[model samples]
Target: MAAVETMVRVGKAAHGRGVFAKRAIRKGTLVGLVQGKVIDDAEYYSDYCIDLGGTLSLEPKTPFCYLNHCCEPNCQLLLTEKRNKDGSLAPSTVHVKTLRGIKLGEELTIDYAWDSVKPLRCLCGAASCRGWIVAVNHVFDKSTAY
Candidate 1:
């Protein structure tokens, strides 16, 4: 394992074992890439998996993938749609680094509202932390948007 990965480990924090930022990460920097093989959403749903990005690989796992869900996230893992050479859709991810610095013990979190599912409650205890990580539209549905 790389020294970076060694700095991080998946363990229970608030909800369950979560990946934490071992070092201070700069905004817009590449935290890491999801090199795991792609799995269909169906497979993703069936597995009840904890890994993010709906893919799995044996490469050195980083704390970035273990980040829990938050209504308001410090950093964002954006999923972009790319057209394959065959004109098919391929989803890729890019990390939107946090505007501010995060301590080593802070949990790396992001809102998981891409689909129609409601956001999960957060336990990170940040003053602005929303109880749930809901869809942006739904977040506006309630009075949590600040």
Candidate 2:
């Protein structure tokens, strides 16, 4: 395994500045915790394009926020649920891991369906890639497991 380090910088992917995995990540493992500067939803909205998979205000530290939403992602974002104002779930610590043995220089992304109803479009160019990224619950017929 490579040393735990910030191997990638926050920059533009399909969406925005998404950090990618620098090396192969094992299954059922922990990636970096998504702790970063607290970004207000209002501020993020003002700055960003405001897509379906944007501004996951779970704990301001969830890996889900860092893991850009991909239609054919190799990672999964598991959320520790907590009740929100409208009886909805909020993420505590979003755990990101490889769904399989991801190759080096690959972007570490996850399906945002665990939280969003419908996500944004993805242009990752995977063979089985879906045209758009949607939430697990609100996933479309073309929605596939990464």
- Overall local distance difference test of candidate 1: 0.52
Q: Candidates' lDDT values, in order?
A: 0.52, 0.54
lDDT of 1 at 20: 74
What digit string (tens of lDDT, one per residue) describes model 2 on residues 44-136?
542212232335453333323555766677776555555679986443554455687666666777655443334455676777665556544
- TM-scores, one per candidate: 0.61, 0.56
Candidate 1's clash total is 3
Candidate 1: residue pairs that collide: 119-133, 119-134, 121-131
TM-score, cand. 1: 0.61
Q: Least lDDT summed over 10 consecutive residues: which range in candidate 2?
A: 45-54
Alpha-carbon shift of residue 53 in model 2 (angstroms): 16
Candidate 1 Cα errors over 4 Å, as ranges: 1-8, 41-65, 94-96, 114-119, 139-146
* lDDT for 103 (candidate 1): 69
